[model samples]
Target: MAHGDITHIDIPVGDTQAARTFYSGLFGWDIAEVPGFEGYPMWRAPNQISGGGLAPRDASFTTPRSYVEVDSIDDTLAQVSSLGGKVLMGKSQISPTSWWAIFEDLDGNQLGLYEGVTSAE
Candidate 1:
């Protein structure tokens, strides 16, 4: 996905398996646990272009979070801070070439930033 695109959406659920089953059955999404992400089951819409994960709900992540693809998490977080937002989570590695971070906007709405090296690149 290109920068600023809505890359992924995380649905916080009390039960991962139940959420997976409900979503897959309801939307006909293909849900499966990826190799490296065992407990987190990823789901892809029938369109194949839209996808997200069923994340275990927690105090910090009580709501669904939308991840926007970004060119640089560091730069984005800096901008966020300058614009009256707060970083909830600093940049963290997702893989050798990928990273993610979470930030809350001025209104306290949380959003995520994702930086990754795609195969197309």
Candidate 2:
């Protein structure tokens, strides 16, 4: 993926199991629980091309948010600020090399940014 490309998406749900069952059966998506991410399960589309996560819903994060891939999280954040957007979450690591962050556009819609290896060697 490249900068501006949607890398991942996070959909908030009240019930993890029920959401998993609904999505898995509805779309035949492969939704499975990740080891460390217990209640939050990752989902892959039927084509097995697009992927994202099904997360527990909360007051501040109840809607589905898409993540755009960026080469540099810091740089992109700076650009976001310059473009009148606000950082809702600072760059944080999901792994040693992978990182993610959330932000709000001028209209207040929340979105995410992803920085790391997007493909396997």
Candidate 3:
């Protein structure tokens, strides 16, 4: 299960339009519905690059399991702290780039920033 990198992530919220508006207005992100995923908006990162998604908080909620792959979980955790975030879960191996953890930023926004790979990365 050595994930080369965190390919994508999904966040579940109760509202789509409000969620979209919040992200779009706050971060200037360009969000669009992923072609095949009905009601799921793929969130664009800064500079208009696709980063992840904002989806419905259904009973089958699954977006909480976001990921942040890293070369070294310890180092990444350190960086998270340096960047004003607190690790909620200590690093746990999911295999190489597949390891994971949770953290809260200074704003108390919970996010999982994984460092992994792409075919080209």
Best by lDDT: 1
Candidate 3: give the clashing pairs: 4-116, 4-117, 5-116, 5-117, 68-113, 68-114, 69-114, 69-115
Tens digits of per-residue lDDT for model 1 on 9-38? 999999988898899889999998887888
Candidate 1's TM-score reads 0.94
Q: What is the C-alpha lDDT profile of model 2 across 1-121, one tens digit per residue?
A: 7788998889999988898899899989898877767777899998777989998899998899999999999999999999999999999998767899999999999999999963332
Where in model 1 is the C-alpha error above 4 Å? 118-121
Best by TM-score: 1
TM-score for predicted model 3 compared with the true structure: 0.47
* lDDT per residue as tens, model 3, 1-121: 2433554577888989999999889988888885445687777688544477786898746455455555676787898899888988877653444455677779876666555433212
Using Cα atoms with residue i matched to residue i, what is each candidate's TM-score against the true structure?
Answer: 0.94, 0.93, 0.47
What's model 1's overall lDDT? 0.91
Overall local distance difference test of candidate 2: 0.89
lDDT of 1 at 63: 93
